[model samples]
Target: MKGKGKKLRKREKAMESGSVEDVLRIDVQNLIVSLNQDNDGVAEGENAAPELETENLPEPGTEIDVKVVELSSTGDGLALHEGSKRVYVVPFSIPGDTVKVKIFRHVLDESYSIADFISVVTPSELRDDSRIGCKYFGKCSGCQFQMMDYSEQLKHKKRIVEKAFRHFSQLPPELIPAIQDTIGSPLQYGYRTKLTPHFDGPPSWRKNREPFTSRPPIGFMLKGTHQTLDIEDCPIGTDVVRLGMKNERARMEVEYGNYTRGATILLRESTRRIPKNESRPSSSPKARSKSPSPLPPDNAAVKVETESYTDVKTCVTSNTATSTEYVGPYVFYNPAGSFFQNNNSILPVFTDYVRQHILPPPSSPSSSPSSSQPIKYLVDAYSGSGLFTITLSSLFSGGSVGIDISDASIKYATENAAANDLPLSRVRFIAADAKDLFTPAIRRAYPGDQTAVVIDPPRKGCDQDFLSQLLRFAPRRVVYVSCNVHTQARDIGVLVRGLEGEGSKGTRYSIESIRGFDFFPQTGHVEGVAVLNRVDE
Candidate 1:
């Protein structure tokens, strides 16, 4: 326990410093390890330099040619240097592509350097620039893998999950299973249901109170810079949200002088159920002529008709306004400003996989022999608006519970369960801290031996306290869903390496599978899900 505590503390200290380069070093090292796994000499590129004079590292702004050997977890290209001790990270470059780059920053302590992509001297077979969808592909910070082929993108994400465990999960290699192929999204582009485009006020405009001669840039931040790029339309956003962006930009132009400071404008797509026979009110000529509509008349107000009802989608700008999204037959409503999955196209596949793996596979009518006791209950941790609980309640014979620290989220989760027509008696929501998850009453109500827990934590991942409680609970199975694979790996590592050698009688967990879902296509972002089964000694 002392050794494990020290290791976790060291990692937490580094994380608290908030240095992106420190995290990148771990990913870069893992990338090099994966590349050379087969001893195939993947690092021996033609342009790779041998152990360089550490003192003679390339000066900042120096131009050099290098062949990319792999891509880091951050979606930057990695090239071997100084015999893999020192590495060069080039943005917007792919492996097997020889590119010219300008050295920008050197992380001497970590033995890696950051470079700006200049031009490709030779392209990788997997590199297809023609596949790029966005006009601001290289310069925009919003996306990283737009220039890459979609199939290759999925493969790279799989590699990212493998590297994540290798680097952050401090477990024996044999304890981990082979990483699964990444699930691809249905829509490669135009899948995002929300977009928050913002613009900064002109410097000192508040004091000057002057009108600008030109329109300010209203878009996302530029890559590697603090400035914003004037993006008129984003291809990644849904059609309704994109139209909202256009309308919002127009409003910003006229109201730029009124703002005291820069602000983010929310454009969240919301859906409402209308009668199948009803005509779209927002699309009517009379409604368009009205002086004030809930949304701009030009903004998309689309009507999708089905046999039972019609779904009308529109973009919501107010933070307090309700935003609706659907995953299969389940509907979810959250504040427009609140966090929800941005890509609706991938929810069906993602949720289905989660449901299938919630418990041990059914080998027979009951449970597998290895898992003698079948899991009949579920606990969805950090469940916002009952995304997992409502969707997964049908599988558990003993019903499910959704828990969150936020009372507002718990309230919404309860309401969402009722709205989805799920039996309130079977589905419940609780607002409580993770540290006090398994109270005496709760333990009696839902026995851990028959319960499966699903955890979907934020990007920072679970803290040590939460992990410790989870280990003590010793549930039948744990399905960890995370956006930040690094933190997920760290947390899972702690759980897998429980206090066995120490004084306590610790329960052990085995990694069943690791898979990534392509929630955001044409981007480096990946959503990872890891399944763990409690081991019987």
Candidate 2:
């Protein structure tokens, strides 16, 4: 394996020494073979670029025309200069959009540069040229796909997952299960359950404008810059969440002096915040609505909006029936800033999918052959606030235990467990570091022989120790959930292939299924869930 890898690297080096096009082609082909499958311009009559203290960047208004060939994993369109070996990342642009761009950031040694989308010289067919998209589409770093068809976004995301696995994982591509199409978000817009708009230093930029109000600008930050792009409303959030921002601003206006420094405020809406009797306007961009809701209650005020995502004091919420256990709703306390799913509408369906993969229905006599192991115990590692741990605990008779690094998360998880009326005998949560996520007692309770382990780690994926301990304690089945498919694929490789130096077995597990969940519509971010089972002894 080492010799083959060295030979592959040598071949890649040779290719790099050749034409840039050859290097790119080979790199792309390898991604498919491995598992695989696979800007610019500004010119003319365009709005002049914003002036700034020019540094080592291209002239503040310099226009460079280029053709966008593809999109980076982050969803930024990429234009390659084969002759110069230069790559430019143009945000809010899509593949096949030939455009002239105004370069904003350029560091020669970095081998690439950043540019703002100026004008589309020849638009891509995938481009949604409705011209009625988000007003802040490009300037605000919020939604990247306002001009992209949602279907195209899903296609690009599916390819992103493929590239992640092909480029990062250590296992053979043939061993990977079929990659499924990305599950689209039911509510593409107005689905965000949370909203956090912040302010920066005193309105220095706005001071020059005539009749400037003392009120600090409120909205999202400009793309790739710290400057705030104040707005009257945000289209992505629910009507309640967006309209409530005005009330928050009103409250902040009165208490503006209380804010001595820049801070991001929080406003979360429980999808259930609005009663069932009310109608939820369609999330389609075509049906984008700005209907207002009553002002948020006075208590919605945030105190000391500190850096740790302070204050859920006002806009607290509960999960809707569809997103949690059918028998009960899991109520999470959001004061401590624990993470939760953003797209509420699809969460229940998403969790249902997870449940489906984790538990294949009992094989009936007449049913097709499908292998399944009835799991007794469950370990929800990285179980922040115990969402999965508490919700899925009742399924396993031997009981379930959750582990998280944050004490706040564990505390809230404990409260949530009680709130959901989860039996203590069957549910538990532990706050521990990565190494201690699984302890002797937790292990003892679950006699690993018949256990199921579900993990949802951050984008970087699992660490070596977690992978080592996971394999060492060999659960009967594993359900790995990740938002970053690249890292998920990398961790999947480590799990399937085991450690590089410690060759204990040919393969420890086999992929049962893989699927993607589109959590953030109009953006590149995606969530993926994969299931695997241990090879029988």
Q: What is the lDDT of residue 145 in candidate 2?
A: 81
What lDDT does the true structure give each of the candidates? 0.79, 0.66
How well is each residue in 3-79 modelled by candidate 2, as lDDT tens digits?
54445334333322212232233333332232211223333221132222223445645787777777777767777
Task: Give the Å error, residue 317, model 1.
Answer: 1.1
The clash numbers for all candidates, in the given order, read: 0, 10
- Name the TM-score of candidate 2: 0.75
lDDT of candidate 2 at residue 13, scale 0 to 100? 31
lDDT of 1 by residue, 68-143 (tens): 8877778888875434446788888888989998888886645578888889888998888988888888888888
Which stretches of candidate 2 lie above 4 Å from their native place?
A: 1-61, 81-85, 107-111, 203-213, 271-330, 360-373, 500-507
Model 1 regions lying over 4 Å from their true place = 1-23, 30-53, 80-86, 205-214, 275-298, 305-309, 364-371, 500-505
lDDT of 1 at 102: 88
- Which TM-score value belongs to model 1? 0.87
C-alpha-based local distance difference test score of model 2: 0.66
